[model samples]
Structure formats: structure tokens, C-alpha cells
Target: MTTGNSGSPISRYTKDRKVGEGTYAVVYLGKQVNNDRKIAIKEIKTGLFKDGLDMSAIREVKYLQELHHINVIELIDVFTAHNTNNLNLVLEFLPGDLEVLIKNTSVVFKPSDIKSWLLMTLRGIHHCHRNFILHRDLKPNNLLLSPTGELKIADFGLARAMGNPNEDLTSNVVTRWYRAPELLFGAKHYVEAVDMWSIGIIFAELMLRTPYLPGKDDLDQVDVTFRALGTPTEQNWPNVSNLPLYNALKVYPPPSRQELRNRFSAATDTALNLLCSLTELNPGKRCTSTQALLHEYFTESPAPTLPSELPKNDVAGGDSDDDEPENKRRKV
Candidate 1:
């Protein structure tokens, strides 16, 4: 085990307060003594650190090191404690993430606020696609809000670089709920459209202040999605029925447009229409992330707010104490 200057295995820069804990790692709020700057440190367990480190962690470090954008979380450094067997990843510590923000506040966002979030989210995802990187995970939790109210996409654990368009990459990725229909249908060969599906889900969630389609599992998720948007037929999603996992689930007739209009009562007509276009059940029919970026929702009057101008920490207000265990640091 290795420690920092403080001589403890994990070192004590600032006493850690638990922020978020996931299956393989726990994120901590810490500071570097030399500069006294706050940072988010993700510590992977020694036992779980496999032959090298996890591929997802390695991919995140490799891609973020070369990809820099205001809308994307910045990775500062990577180091190991003096005596510990685990690896430490240091990242810019943003005050809060969108998940906590949406949950804590009851404020109905102005259309402008919604557009700002949508635009920033697309800009960040667009940058990733331009670089040939796909952010497979893009739910509210992975989208962090800076103290300045700007949103930065974080948690690139499931991200991957695209290869030949015809090649089949990994199938077991993306969280179940935000997963695109192609992924749920076992289309190993996919493209950036997968990310666009998540963006559509996110857009609906932002408007509704809840998950757009909350399914209990993969099958249920598909059922919920098709139920809302209507099942894809040969005319709707041409190649969808040919997908690997495509099977005859009891087919229900498509729902009327009136049903959809009533379902998204809070969303604007333009926004609802765009959501329908982007969330097409067939990968071939789904809109690209870049196309969605150019949609009228972003071009309307009272345009989206520039990220730098957004209010910082408007979503959540909290602080961390230095006396807690390093592993327990909570994200602000």
C-alpha cells in the first residue's frame, strides 16, 4: 500500500466525504495540498483491479486525455497511492450533477432553461461523435453541473471508439433504460445513433422531470418504448424486424398521434415533434446527434443560453466536511 505525503496508505489531502459509490469504485471529494484545489477522486478497489485496470477506466482515461471541450468533464491526472494496490483517477470537481439537481428542486424550468441544457448536452455529445468516440452512457447522472450552472458530460466509463461501420462492437454496454432500440434488439453493429437515442430520452426526461421510459428490464423497456411511440412496422422502421433479437412479441396496433400529444402535455409542440423524430425505433430511421443539434428547438427565439452564462449551482446547494473518511466523500 502507498500513501500520499500524509503517510497514510490513501494519503490525506483533504479528509474525504463520500459522494457517490458505484459497483466497482467509490468517488470521493478531495483536494490537492500543494495547490489546495478541489478534485473528484475515483478509487478502484485493489481486488477488482483485474490484470491491469478495468477496460472502461482505461478507455475513459485514454479518450479524455486527448479530447477537450467545455461541455465535457476534464480529467486532471492519474496516480497511485504510495502503498495501496488500487489506482487513483483525479478529475475536475464540479459541484453537482443533473440527477441530484432535478431531484432536489421543484422549480419548473423555463423553455430557455430546457433549451440550454439540451443544447449543451448535444454540443458535448456532438464533440464526442466528431472524434469517433461514443458516449454509451448519457443519462442525467453522467451529466454534471458546474458551480457556474454549466453542464459537463461526465462518467465515460462505458464510452468506446467506433470502428468500421459494418463491424459489430461490444453488445453488453449502455444502461438498460437509456439504451437505444438497436442495442436492446441485439444489433452488435451500431453507430452514433445509439447516443442520439439516449439524448432523446434525456430530452423527454428534462421536460417531464422524470425518466421518460422507466422499464423494469430489457424486455419491459422495449415494451414501454414501443407502447409510447408505437411499434415499428415494415413501413415505420424498415430494417428493424430483421435485427438479431427481433421476434414476434404480441403486436399491438400503433397508437394515434392524439395519444402522444396528450402524453407529453408539458412539452412544446416543436419539442415533442423533434423528440418523435429522434427516438425512431429503427436505428436507420433515428436522427443523428448532429442533426438533432440543428433542430429548430435550438434555433427558436430566446436561443439556448451559452454554457458560460448559466447560473452556477442553481440546481443544488450543499457542502462537504473534511473530517469524514476518505472513501465516504459525497459529491456536492
Candidate 2:
């Protein structure tokens, strides 16, 4: 809505056009005048200097500035509007996000498509883990697909860099559906494994074309996850029983393996097996992003599709007509 000076250093190369908006910031399509490069500019409301910019927005900028990987969205520049007291973040503009693509396409993805996405997503998250960064929020909406169909993990608002393995951070992180079991059970001393859980959920979503476990609330979410994967036993998730919130709820016996196989009938055995390992109810038992990337699932036959090789436009048809109501479609 508001345009700043064209000649200013911060706004020098970028021409802004509105693209997306959210509760805390507005995203714009920005083009670099000199290079003719297009990028996404996220403008955060910063009039209230007393409270400072939102921590989530600040966290995104800080970590993304340090991370460099092809699977991660690139942060091009940072700017601030002089008179309006707004902070602007310039990012490489992705053509569309996975949510939009999945909704638009009727074409069924071959196992290769799923493998490519999973590989890319895990690689991105693995990069974060290597740097001690954890992407607390990971979901379809947060994953952007370039016009060529290469998947890039975006939106690091809820991401954090862990300082010490033993230190406990805030428990209030991650989106509910993609949250790890340790987080759900109120474990603040989590590791990169948390992001792996989300990747598992994303992997399952890609394969099924639907959310794997959609819980109405935190309690219900944990219930659904455990029900689908079977409750964690002492053997499977050792420290789970010691979590702060672990005792508040009654435990159910673990579900039969056949039940899981039946529920995800369309998934290949390797895919289902990996999902189960990643989504283990105990964070300790869950597979790390790096380990999942090395699994047999990705090593079969031809390598996954590279970013430049994916279908560009109209790969399917148009956006799906069965999109959920605006209010019900939760953003990560």
C-alpha cells in the first residue's frame, strides 16, 4: 500500500508490487531495476519501536541471512522505509508454493516426484541442522515451488538457532500440525530432530495429496499422531515418559503395523517405512534429516528431478476447485 522513495539506497533497485499479505507483514513482488531480477519483499509493521519488530520476523531475517543452500529461499537484501518505520526484507521470488501447486494439479505424481520433493526438503532442513538452526515451522504453505517445480523451503519465522544441547528454549514454537512429539509433550530441550518430524508430515502430505494427521487442537493432534503411528513404548521412545506433559494424558496401546499399512495404502513400502521412522512418537527415535536423505527410497534408479527440469506452468490445469474455506485453511 505504501511506496517509499525510489532513489534511496534501500529501495534503489527494487520496484515493489503487492503479492501476499499476512497478520504481521505484507509480501510484495520486487524487481531489481539494474539486473531486472525479481524478488519477494516482505514488509513488517515497525511503527512501534517501543516493542520492537516482531521476534519471529527478526528471527527469519537473522538466520536466513546466514544460511546459503539451493533448497532454501535466498534473502537478497534488507531495507527500511524512512518515514513509515517499516522493515523490508527482499527475497528471491518463487513462482508458486507447493500448496497452490497441489491444489491446482490433477496430475498424479509419480514416486519420483515425491522422492524429488522429499529429497529437496530434507536437504534444506539438513543444511539448517548442520548450522544448529531448527525450522520450527515446516508445512506445504511454507514450501515454495519455482516455476520449474524445484521445491525451496521458505518462511523461517519460527526457526531458531540452538545454543546448547542441554539448554531449554521456549516451548511455544512450531505450527501445531507439523510440530514434533517432543514439542507437543512440552520438551524444550529439543534438537534438529523436531524439523525432521515436520518433513515426515510434509512427505506424507505429498504422497497422499492431503494432510497426514490433521488435529483440531494440541491434545487432539498428539492423539491423532500417536493413533496413526501407535503410542510410543518405553523401547521405542525412551525419554518420552519423562516429558513434562507426558503424564497428563492417558496412554493407549500401540496400533498394529497392519493398521498403518492399511491407512496409507497408496504409499510405497519404502515411503511408508521412512514416514514411520521420521514420525516416531519419541523424538529420540526419529530419523534425522541427513539419515532420511540417505535412505534406500531416494537411491533407486534415476536420481530425483533437479529444480530446472520440473514442469513450469500449467503442469496440471489450474488451481483446484475444492480448496478449503479461507478461514479453515491454516497457514504455517
Candidate 3:
């Protein structure tokens, strides 16, 4: 909240090096001047747009300022640079992300390891949803990993607080691959179930060690999604035809239980149950974050591996200590 020409809040942190550059901002790896704590500074280019600043940058600042959780990225500081008047957000420095680990074939992912990541993701989103915030974009790349192995959900650019019943929300949110059936069908009014669907896809990705439903484009997304999960119809989805873009879609029979079992061969029955519930075609039927947290999948044998004990991106062997007594396992 401080402003100055030479002495300002921006002077409080040192930008060591530029790590990434996007259309609206440049990310720098730096440290807090006082404590020497590492941080990532996102320098927003204020002059790029005629309107002054990008909405994504505004949303990131607005939402992250209100959210505080171990599994959520912390917005450490916000300030405008002295002369250029450019905005900079100091965020916690996360060295790794889930996408890296998932794409790295050498890093083997155990059932428990997958459970830990999914659990952390759920916890983070649960907090957001409970606060009436929708993290429209929930994917592996947005889920960052701390040095201590904690998974923190990042990227609030596409996020917005849940709107009222009469308010029309945008259906064109969330990444194409992780998008929910409702969003795919162009539903203008959606609930937190959208986030649930993304988490479900992420869960599947973690288990398979690859993207589960890799759709080529928007049209192909619908085809690939339905071809794999089956087409949504009134019978199973209940009034799904009422949606804006529900017409003219190929119908594929829902996968048999055995088919699902075969698809996720290594998953436990409980794990599959949670997955199906989360990915339920109907937003009404999709599992809520609260319900998912309490699902039997978390309580069943082979409890979630401790975050610190989870596999590392650099560790090709992906060894785990699942053999440790369950009683010693503390909830994340």
C-alpha cells in the first residue's frame, strides 16, 4: 500500500533473475530484503493495455489477498514500482509443479503418492469453494510444490467468486481437457462441481502418469470426453438437454463398471468410487469437496503418503514409505 519514487514497497524485495515472461507479466526469482526469504515476483506490465491493467492480474491480486491456507499459494506482498508504476506481486517461491512429475516417465507414482497429491488439491479447492470462490482453472501446472513437498494451488487469474442464482456465469472457463461436462455443454450457470471435475481428471492423470482425456480441440474435447466417459443424456444426467450447447452430439453408451475397472486397473475400488463420483457427468451428481474429503478413499488401506514423503520430480525410482504403520500417518 506504500508508494514512492525511489523508496517504496518494491524496494523491499530484490529481483534476482527473470524466470518466466507472459503477455502481461514477467516472473522473477528473488528474496525478501529483510528476511532473505525466497519469493517469486510477478511484475505486471501496466502500459500494455489501453484500459491500464489486465483483468487476470487484477483477479490474482483481489482473490489471493483474501485466501490463506497451507495448500493455497500465499500472496506475500503487492506494490507498484517507483518510476514505471508497474505492479508487482511477491508470491511464495515454489520450485516445482505436479505437471513436471506427472510428465517425467522416470518418476514412478504409487497409489499412496497419488492420494497425497489429490488430497492436498482437494483440501485447497475445498477451502476456496467453501469461501464461495471458484478456481476455474485447476490443473497440474497450477498446482505447485514447495521445497518441503507441500502441494499449493496457485494461479487465480481465471478464478471468480460464485455468482448468485440469477447471475449468468461464463461457461468458457477452466482448461479444455479438465472442463466439466456442464461447461462443455455451455451451461451458463454452474456450481463448484466444475472444480471437482478438474480434480477428478487430475486424479486420473496422476494415476496414469499422463493426461487422461487429451482432447485435440473444443469440438474434439466433446467427442473425446464422451467417447471415453460416455455421452450425457437426460436419462443419466437429468434434463441435460436444457443446456445451451447440448444439442447435436453423438451418443455413446456409458462405460460398464468393468470397463471403468479396466481403465483404471491399478486403482482400488474405493479410489474408483471417488473418481466416478467426482467426474459424474451431472453437476448435481458430482461430488462436493466436503463429500470427497470424507470419502472412504482417504480412510481405506494404504493411506495417503505424507507430503514430505511423497515422490520427488528428480527421484526416478519414486520410492515411498507406504509400509510404515497407518497409525503413524497424520492427516495432511
- Give the top-scoring candidate (TM-score): 3
**Whole-model lDDT values for every prediction:** 0.76, 0.75, 0.86
The all-Cα superposition gives candidate 3 an RMSD in Å to the true structure of 7.1
lDDT of 3 at 127: 95
Candidate 3 CA-lDDT value = 0.86
- For residues 1-332, write the lDDT of model 2, one tens digit per residue: 23344567464556445655677787766666656666667888765457888887899899999999988999887888778768888888676667665665665666777788889898888999999898888888888876556678888888888877678787667778888878888887888888898888888887778888899998898898777766766687786788888875656777666776787787767777898888877777788877898898888655687766654434432333222223111232
- Rank by TM-score, descending? 3, 2, 1
Better of 1 and 3 by lDDT: 3
Where is model 1 more than 4 Å wrong at Cα?
1-18, 306-332
lDDT: worst 10-residue window of model 2: 321-330
**What's the count of clashing pairs in each model shown?**
20, 0, 0
What are the per-residue Cα lDDT tens digits for candidate 3 across 1-332?
Answer: 22233566776788876677778888877777777677888988887899989999999999999999999999998998668788888899777788877888888888889989999999999999989999999999899887689999999999999877899999999989999989999999899999999999999998888899999999999999999899988888898999999889998988899999998999999999999999899899888999999999999989889998988764322223122121110111
Candidate number that wins on TM-score, 1 or 2: 2
Ranking by lDDT: 3, 1, 2
State the TM-score for model 2.
Answer: 0.88
How well does each candidate superpose onto the true structure, as a TM-score?
A: 0.86, 0.88, 0.92
Instruction: Kindly indicate the candidate among 2 and 3 with the higher TM-score.
Output: 3
